[model samples]
Every structure is written in structure tokens, then in C-alpha cells.
Target: MVQSLAGMMVPADIFLSWGVQFPSVLATVAEKAAEAAEADGTMVLLAVLLSLVAIYTASKVGGEFFNWLGFPPVLGELVGGVVIGVSAFNLVVFPETGGNADNSLIMLVLSATAGLDPSVAEPTFEVQSEVVSILAELGVIVLLFEIGLESNIRQLLEVGVQSLVVAIVGVVAPFVAGTVGLIAVFHVAPIPAIFAGAALTATSIGITSRVLAEIGRLSSKEGQIILGAAVMDDVLGIIVLAVVASLAKTGEVDVTNIIFLIISASVFLVGAILLGRFFNDTFVALAEQFQTRGRIVIPAFILALLLAYVAAAIGLEAILGAFAAGLVLDETEPGKELEELTKPISDVLVPIFFVTVGTKTNLSVLNPAVPENRAGLVIASFLIVVAILGKLISGFSVFGVENINRVAIGVGMIPRGEVGLVFASVGSESGALSPSLDVAIILMVILTTFLAPPLLRVVFRDEEPEAAEPDTPA
Candidate 1:
């Protein structure tokens, strides 16, 4: 049968009665490849949309419950993140988190619900996680911009001298106390000690600014000083980070870079405000020409993004630029219109920033059951004390301001938040810090961030609560 079949001439287009094509096989292959790529891209977008669903659910439920309990909604948003994050349900874990996000409950649900291919699951989750992270970052940027819009520039300037004092003390005291005590008592090596000490100097401008705005004290004299000091601390924190990073890489600090960072930060901030003032009239005039759907907001957002980009290029925080953009727009005729438009956008995005801050935190580092974590807990205790007291004391360092809630100023600077993570990450990556010391810094950051919101409310409880969610500057 095989010989007969082989001998038979079956082709030649079935003896010229039929035809088949073969050369387009490569084109077919390419078409299938394109389809697969498109499918994968769609899956990534689906995954991101699902993640946002979980995020928004957590944020709102947590926020409402906490707000009902008479606490700051930000606290609930954080706790919500902790619940859904790597520490708990794994619903919103990041990719670097041991690939747990790919196997998270949300991802699994997505797979089961969508008939997602197992082969593409990993890449989809990775891309989804990254997109979420970028959105979270944008959230914080918008938060800072909104804050800058609400703040009184003249008021901040009024407390500028005091804020400078507070920022300097906040940086120096913790850095000295934590660094010296570690070397003297723990006998930690110089580099690890310095890196850990550097961790103490960060003040979460995002957290403090949100809390101040919530309690309606954002326009208060004390609030102005705290926000101003926090911004200054951010610039100083970057400088310290640069110095320590240089030391870690080369065992030498860059004096010239430090000087340049200082000068550039000052110039960037001053120039942003000056330019804003210089262009206020022109900005307003330009706005009058646009008669489109986003007439009021599009221009303002463009300015914010541009300034944020310039600030990053100059080695300063992008939020500073966004904040500067807000200040500039606030001086324009469209200031109120811009504020109204920004609120809805802030509502959508800012919660992602708060929630993600909680998600990235690994509470496992504080487990006393683990012998390794025990040492971290012990060291964390010391750092916490130093972190809290060092910053609190700086509030009292504010001189010539009578009847100021010096404690609030200090407490405002207490939360290390995500800024502390930058230091810990660098230390771990450089091998400058032992696992135990790294964990200790994480604990300090977590506790300080968790504690500051309630503490701020307590400190300001005596004062009348500012209008909850004030739409205009006080």
C-alpha cells in the first residue's frame, strides 16, 4: 500500500484540477505572531483595569470605614492596602515581591474569569504591576500639585525662616543621633550606620500634606511651616541620599555634587516661583484664547508636567515642580477653575499613591517569631525612638513664633513613608547594611508613617477643625 501510494502522482495541483499556495506561510506566521502580541497587550490592559478595581474598592471601603470611625481617611486607605497587599491577601502585590502578584487572588480570579493563557500570565502581571506603579507615582505628583495650589505662598514664605530652622534640625538631629548611637552602641560599621541614619532624615511630604489638608489646617501658620519644612527636608534628603549613594559605590562623598544639589534645589524652587509670577499675566492671557473642553485644565496640566520634568532633570523632586506649577497657576485668573477641575482627578489618582505606599511595605520584616527579625525589632525600637524624638524636638527649635504648636510641626515631619524605602533599598543593594539593619529601617518607616496621622489630629484637636475638604485656601 505504501509503495502504490508513493508511486501515484498526487500533486501538480491535482493534475491541474485544483490549486494550493505555500509561499504565504511566512506571512501567515507573521500574522499569527501579531495577533498573539495584540492579545497579550489586551491582557495586560485587562489586568491593569482589574487591579484598579481592587484598588478603588479597597481605598473606598477602607476610607469610608476609617472616616466613619473619625480617623483620617488616609489611614484607612493605607490599612486597606496592607490588607490586600503582599502582607495579607496578595491582591495588589508588586512584581519585585517574589512574583507573588502573578499568583495573587486578583490575578487568579482574572485568569479564571478571562480564560487567560498560563504562558502569558507572568508577563501580563509584570506589565500590569508596572503600569500601576507609574499611576501611583502620578497620583503623588498630582497630590503635591493640589497641595501647592491650596497653600499660601506668602504664608509659606512668612514661615520660611522658621521652616528652614525646622528642616535643618530635623535633618541634623536624627542623622547625628541615629548615626552616632548606632556606631557607639550597636557597633555597626561606619557606612551602614550612616546609611541607616540617613533613613531617619526623610519626612513624607505626601502624608503630612494630605493630613494637614484633611484637618483644614493646611493654611494655618503652623501648617505652612510644616509643609515648607517638609519640602526643604525633601531637598536635603535627596542630597543626603546622593552623598551616601556615592559613598556606597566608591567609599567617597562627592562634596562638589552636594554643593551643586543645594544650589540647584534653591535655584529650581526660587526660579519656579519667580517665573510663575513673571508669567502669571501671560498664562492668564493664553488661557483666554482656548475655547475647548479642557480649556482651563489642559494648559495648567501642561505647565505642571513641564515643571515637574525640569525639576527631575535638575536633581530635585518632580513634586516640587508640580507644587511650583500649582503656586504659579494659583496666581492666575484660572486658579479657582483649575482647583475645581483638579479635585475630581485627585480623587481618582491620589488614593493609589496612598494605597501603594502600604502595599510595598512588608510587615513580615517585623516578625518576632523569626530570630533574625528579633534583632531587627530591637534595633527598630531604638531607631523609632530616635526618629520620633529627633524630629519632634525640631519643632521646638522653631524660634520667634509665639503660640505655635511646635509639637505639630515636629510630628508633621515624623512619617518616613516611602522616602525611607529609598534609603533601605540603596543600603541593601550596596551591601552596606546587614539584613537586620535594613529591616530595622523598614520598621522605623512603617511605624513613623502609621503614627504621624493620628498624632497630627491629636495635636490639632484643640484648634477648630478646618473645613473638611476645603475647596479654597483658608
Candidate 2:
């Protein structure tokens, strides 16, 4: 039935192109719709709307299908986006190449103008791209915020020592392994090497959190440690990014600037948590006066956005601020209320984030048949192994946490996802990394993100009952 329904939805062109014609009225309506779309400058708008519908539908179907297969739904969403995006079917196309104006819708309009007036087309394609980018950014912020809502300061503090060790090891091991391995074995340039190393330092809290949530383990000890470690990893990753970006720009690392960045990030996170705790009740009291249905949600979301903005302003990732916002709100009288209210929004936005991440992954770079790209494939493969080993080693760093699944914690930290992409983007823009190196990093992100969820499921599946069982006499 499902296959038949899908078959019916295929365009009539496939079967009727030989000689068939629509009824006159139907043809007229279709013609008029096309003409109107072309005449009123609504082509871009129509494309955007259709793109959203297609993405959401595909994401839902793919996610559900993946879930049915005993895997995390997000894996399916990512795969769905890749299938629908320019990387596969080219159904939802972006500019063929980054920063080339030739693919802009405005440029097409300008061409139609025949040089009569070039100024008429105002780069509408760029505007549309920006809009989509903003939406993707919002999706990630809300995702982190949701993760934060599920976590509390006490849980973070309780796992503080172990998490700290895990985070430090996670960051240092990957960075050192990537930098040293690339330099010594691959003979890569120093700047690009550093960018690769910096990229390795990121742990996608979004991916890890979703996997834990899917498995109903978000409140487990391993979950808490992974979450806490991811938060620390974010701070450390951003600082490393800033330092590497500076080094790339100046050809030398400035010690003072790196110190300042670290201090600023630390203060921002610590300060946000402290301030949120001190003033959470006051904000909750103020929110009580508004008797509307979304009173709690509206204020909570605004705070999340505001803090996210502040975090971005301070050179940290905006999602960090959003996470901090969640941590702050999770302690208040309205904390649980806010989570219940904001869940619907997260549900809509978070899948878009994962899908967008998928769309950005260009699998063509991994084609071994392409001789030029084979080296990149080799580099990416090596970095991926390094990436896995680096994070996996961090799990065992927790000495005192007996019976804790250190392997689960390590696997949870493996997916680099959007954060690694961000590092790669910055490096590419800075000219710090060569195109091959950038592609390698992207491939690393794709592999890590794709593999972590299933590996996590395997690690955590049987351990749940064991973890929950009370201590018994042998």
C-alpha cells in the first residue's frame, strides 16, 4: 500500500511524455500557476516552501524507518537529508560551489534582464541561503537548550571530577594524536595539521544527547558524565578554534590572545551558570504574573535566545549559551514546565538541524576512483581512526567511578557532527586548511557522526539492567 501510494505521487511525465495530455482546464490551471510564480517573483519563495515540506517529510519518514530497524532515528534523518540534498538526488540544490555568485537566483534574474538594468536582481538567492542557515543555527541552539533542560547543576557537579578528567583527556588525546600523526605520518603542513587537531576536540553534545534520549538513558550515570564532559569539550573546543584561527591568520600563535580567549570562555560559562542560579527564582516569580498558556515557554525561550546571542558575542559558540540557559532554567519552579512547553518546538527544530548537517556532507570527496581525492580519503580515514581512539581512551580516565560503563561514556563522546563542521568551515574560510584537508575533516565528521549512535546502542543495551540492579550478595 505504501509503495503504491508513493508510486502514484511520481510525476506524470515519467509515463505520459509520449503523447498524453491533461484536460484543458487542468492544463490551463497548471500553466497559470507557473506563469504566476514566474511573473510575481515568487519562484524563490515557492522553492523555499517546497524545500521545507520535502525536508520535513523525508526526515520524518526516514527517521521512522530507521527507528523501525532498531537504530537511532537521527541516523535515518541524516541519511534522508543526504539522499534528498544536492549530494545525492540534487532535489534541494544550493549553489554548486560555495561563494560563487553564478548560481544565485538574482543572477538568473539579471541574465533575463539582458543587461538593461543589472541592479534589479538583489541577490535573492543569497538571502534565501542566509534564511536557511539561520533556521539551522536556531535548530542547534534549541537542541542544546533541550539537553541543558534535561540536566541540572548538581548532576554536573556530582560528575564534575570524573567529567573533567574525561573532557580533558578527550580534548588533549585527540588534539595531540591528530596533530602529531598528521605531521609525522602524513607530512601535512603545520597550520592545517593544527586545524585538523582542533576539529578533533569537538564532541557533538547534540548527537550524543539524542542517542541517550532515544535509549532512555539520559539520566544514567554514563549519560551525566558524557553530558558534562561534552559541555566542557565545547568550551575547550571553541577556545582551541579561536587559537587555531588566529594562528592561521597570523602564521604564529599569540599566547596572550589564547589565554584571554580561554579566560573569557570560562568566565562566560561559569558566570552564566552562577547568575542563572542566583536569579532563577526572581525570573520565575516575574513570569507568574503572565496568565497566558505560553507565558513560561515564551520567557524561557527568550532567555535561551538572549544567552545564546551573548555567548556568540563573546566569541563562544551560541549553543553553549543556550545550554547554559537550560541549566539555569532547570532549577526554577517553572523548570519542568518550561521543558514540557518547549518540547514541541524542539521536536520541530532539532530534526531540521540533523538534516541540515546531513545535507552539508558531500560524499563525493570519498570516491577512491578520483585519484586526486584518494589522498584526501586516506587522510580522512587516518584521522577518523585517530578521532575514535582519542575519545575512546578518555572513558577509562575516570578512576573512582566503579561499575560505570567507561566505554559507553567514551562512545557517547565520539560523534563530532555540527561542531566539527563549524571548525572545518572556519578553517576553510581562514585559508588555514587546504581544500583537501577541509574535505578530510568533513569526512571525519560524517564517519564519526554516522557510527557513534549504533555503537552507543550496542554498548548501552544490556548494561541498563545491570546498572539498575541493586547490589546483591554473591
Q: Best-fitting candidate, measured by lDDT?
A: 1
Candidate 1 worst ten-residue window by lDDT: 1-10
Where does model 2 exceed 4 Å of error? 1-41, 96-122, 187-192, 203-252, 400-409, 415-439, 449-464, 467-474
lDDT of each: 0.76, 0.72
Q: Give the per-residue lDDT digits (tens) of candidate 1, residues 262-283.
A: 6776677678889889778877
Tens digit of lDDT per residue, candidate 2, span 1-474?
Answer: 001122211222222332444475356445434433333244445445655776787689888997797555666777787776646755444542352235433344434643312332333343344445556667878877886787666765676788999999999999999999999998998888988999999998877877777777777889888989987787677657766765675576567866776677678877998988777877788788888777788888888989987876555567778878888899998888888888889788877766765665566766888898888888988999999999999998988767889899999899987678668756764667775677688778878988998999999878643233232100
lDDT of 2 at 283: 77
Over the full model, what C-alpha lDDT does candidate 2 score relative to the true structure?
A: 0.72
Error of 1 at 60 (Å): 1.2
